[model samples]
Target: MSELPMTVRVDGLPDRVTIYEVGPRDGLQNEKTVVPVEVKAEFVRRLVAAGLPVVEATSFVHPRWVPQLADAAELMTALGEEGRHLPVLVPNERGLDRALELGLEHVAIFGSATETFATKNLNRTFDEQFAMFEPTVARAREAGMDVRAYVSMCFGDPWEGAVPVDQVVTAGTRLLDLGAGQLSLGDTIGVATAGHVRALVAAFGDAGVGTDRLAMHFHDTYGQALANTFSALQAGITTFDASAGGLGGCPYAKSATGNLATEDLVWMLDGLGIEHGVDLGAVVATSTWMAGHLGRPSPSAVVRALAG
Candidate 1:
């Protein structure tokens, strides 16, 4: 295991990055086979041991919706007293209630920027979807929990091509208004280019959503996730969402692919001398172990190249 090179000064890029690890939740939820509660817990423990500051532990969505994460409660219980900032996905008030019962303190709410995706993913209109999460985020904040809102399909939608930048800003602003302190712009279909990434971040900033409150979550379907990440970094976004081993994709979006791999992201950050407090070797080991559990090779190019 080699050391990461010394941090370099990249103009406009943050000196430190907060990688919100989503492998245990978003990454595993998309898997066809149900991961055992024990494996999920161990996976999270490994990620934390590898120095991830924040990890999304699991989603509280109904079992029918994401059968893979059906043991959300049990899994959280198994991760008892880790003292990590484990943020779980709460689809609505019910999910939030369930999470609160376990003494969880952080949560993420999700909504879509495109009407087609909103309708298809949540079975609700754009307004209806926000209505669903608004109360959830409100109650969570009242309970003194930190909340993050994810705006999915921000760049492009499967049914609707090229989502307007204004639409994404509107969705993000609404979430910020709903008491979500952080908003993650998701390229759910992996259709965003570098130019699109910069423009969207700038639009949000113009709408008064500061880069400090924004995060980027990209898919590697067309292998643009890292490029989009760099674009966002230049745009002053310091937080990002990634999955270990590139383990997840949008089940709702047919053309969607695995997420930006944690190792891949770290590799680039290492070379650029940006300061993300993650061990590249440790993450590669974690992802490699997880891929074996999934019975497939890792989708991360960095992981493979490192193994060689």
Candidate 2:
């Protein structure tokens, strides 16, 4: 049997990268079954114990919109101190208020790079979406919270064909200008290629947005996530958004599949000798345990390989 790969250095790649774990929030958001609040909290604990520096806890989005996370308040209450440091998704001022009431300090805002996605997902025009985010971000910043802006559909939109790189840069810059400490570029549909990833990062670089202020979130729908990640590494990106066991996808965009698997990503980084501070065996065990709750096997190839 093939064992875990030996670490090998890759030039131009950062010595260590931050693996932003999104399992609790993005991973469980689209679950058909409402994962128990305790189970979700335990998931966070397990991820933390596995050395994931950042684990997105849950979203404060309205229950009607995302029923899977309806127990956001209860989850936060259950997590208490552990939850405070974790970032939660706040769709608007109301969501932010919920987070604030729970004493959470870090938050994330979701934005769309295309007009159709903005309209379909957020119920606002692409141009009007920023206005909605403005108040929430301002309030969060006023409260001394770090805000992350997620620009979805960065590569291509289901409703709109190819999203212009310039348009994505424009939207990303606008969100950055709105007090977001970092911007996560998302391939919501998982249709991006390595070339597209380079072009977009280069465009952002030209716009004066350094790679440090950027993160990449890709799905495995088209199986290009790993390639895209390598491209981002070549572009000097140090932060990546991944979900444990390849859980979750875009609920608003039906075409999207699971996110880039955290275990799979860690495996690649391990082979590349990139220090991403995660225990792959622990993550695999965690995902295996969680998968039992979800009533299916993990979609992550590394999980299947290692768990087997």
Candidate 3:
């Protein structure tokens, strides 16, 4: 058998890429069982040490909504004078209040592009969910928090099927107008293809949204996350979201898998000579550690190959 190609040199690649590591929050949020608070903290610590600039620490959502992150407050407190930007997910005003009480300066708000996914995932219509975020975003800004808005199911929705490109662009622009510092387009069900990614970026650009203010969040469900990422990069998007060890699944979408792994992203970036300032080896080690703790093999190919 031919040896697997580790990386490719795509011409005209971006000089630098910003990795927003979401392992702590997104990766661990969907686990069937609750991970120990200390272990979660350690995972964040190791991620920071790996030279990731932005590490999503935890979510401030109510325990009833997500029991896996019930220890959000404690996890935030325990991150301990971090090495990376620690952002937490705030689902609403209450979650924002909790995040403020924890003295968190960076928080993210999530909304959906498709009404079906929004209703199923957040239990509200698209308009209702967007309305709920207005006050939350205002409050976070008032409290001096940097707010990032996640637009889930941007390319396609499992429930609604192929999402209209205009719908995605409208949602993203609305979030930006509502004071989202950055807009992250999420391929929540991992159904996005490279062509879908390019179309989405073009739509956003047509709406006058700067590519620099956008981030791409892809899941590896159909094994298109990395290829979709390449499409985004070609479209002038430098910021991307990833989870270490490929942790996280869409709690609302049953068929979804974890986000793209940080190890794989770093490996790809390094081979492309992209400047991410992340230690690939350390990221691989961290993924291995977390995977072991979860009693499962890592979903990251780079972690498995490099460890061997």
Candidate 4:
């Protein structure tokens, strides 16, 4: 039997999609142990060499908040010249300054769609969170950098239960208004069904947030990430956030699990004949290598099958 999926062209889906790889940053933030900066650097290199178009390198968040990525500066140094092109997560103006000092051109900020999450993760009230992001986004744009906003917990929140579609759109559009070129709608708890996914995207569209400005970030907590991704694609979404070897989850949200695995997403995109510009065999090898260092089996079904 062949490892590739039979190509069956699907209508309404874009001819080519961009897979935003988050394994280095989002993937390792939750690790119980601090991954060496050298290993993190190599992980990013392997993924980039594997044909991933965009690899989010690391976050400049406080080391006390995410100790796994405490060596963000060192990791950037390890990446050297290439680091300037890769996007890094920066929590505030201070974080943005760190990225700027390193000559990075791309940065992303994390925002919450619900009050509870804002309080828990950001330690700010819902309204106050925007105030915190405004300056960071403004300065990043002023510095000629591309700003990507992540509206996390868009689908559901563990403390607040199911979130309203309108609420998420409001937060997302506001971030876009704040000079974010793109927004990644995050299903932090992975409780969203396909209908919920389509509805949320539609709500954003109704609010004048075009499909071009939106990307989907799904968790596999409820095993609904792939199905929800299909829903987003059916709704004309072309950008997806995935982690290689199924690494990543919300460090603040205990209910969250690994992100949609890049290998698995590639497998589906390949089967669907979507041009994501990723090499499945190369991705599997990279994830397999990273998994070896992590000392754990990959949660990705495709990696387990192909790398076994």
lDDT of each: 0.89, 0.95, 0.87, 0.93
For candidate 1, lDDT tens digit of each residue in 218-290? 9999989999999999988999999998989977888999999999899889877787788889999999988
Pairs that collide in candidate 4 are none
Backbone clash pairs in model 4 (N, Cα, C under 3 Å; residues 3+ apart or in different chains), count: 0
- Which numbered prediction scores highest in lDDT against the true structure? 2
lDDT score at residue 39, model 3, on the 0-100 scale: 91
lDDT digits (tens) for residues 1-308 of candidate 4: 58898999888888889999999999999988677888899999999998999999999999999999889998998899999999999999899999999999999999999999999889998889999999999999999999999999998999989898899998998899999999999999889899999999999889888899999999999999999999999999999999999998989999899999999999999989999889899999999988888889899999999888
Per-structure clash totals for the candidates: 0, 0, 1, 0
Instruction: List ranges where model 2 is wrong by over 4 Å.
Output: none
Q: Ten residues in a row with the worst lDDT in model 1? A: 1-10
C-alpha lDDT (0 to 100) for residue 183 of candidate 4: 99
In TM-score terms, candidate 4 sits at: 0.99
Candidate 2 lDDT tens digits, 67-177: 999999999999889889999999999999999998998999999999999998899999999999999999999999999999999999998989999999999999999
Candidates' TM-scores?
Answer: 0.96, 0.99, 0.95, 0.99
Query: Residue 246: error of model 2 in Å?
Result: 0.2
Quote the lDDT for 106 in model 4. 98
Each prediction's RMSD over C-alphas, in Å, is: 1.6, 0.8, 2.2, 0.7
Least well predicted 10-residue stretch by lDDT in candidate 4: 31-40
Candidate 1, residue 85: how far the Cα is off, in Å: 3.6
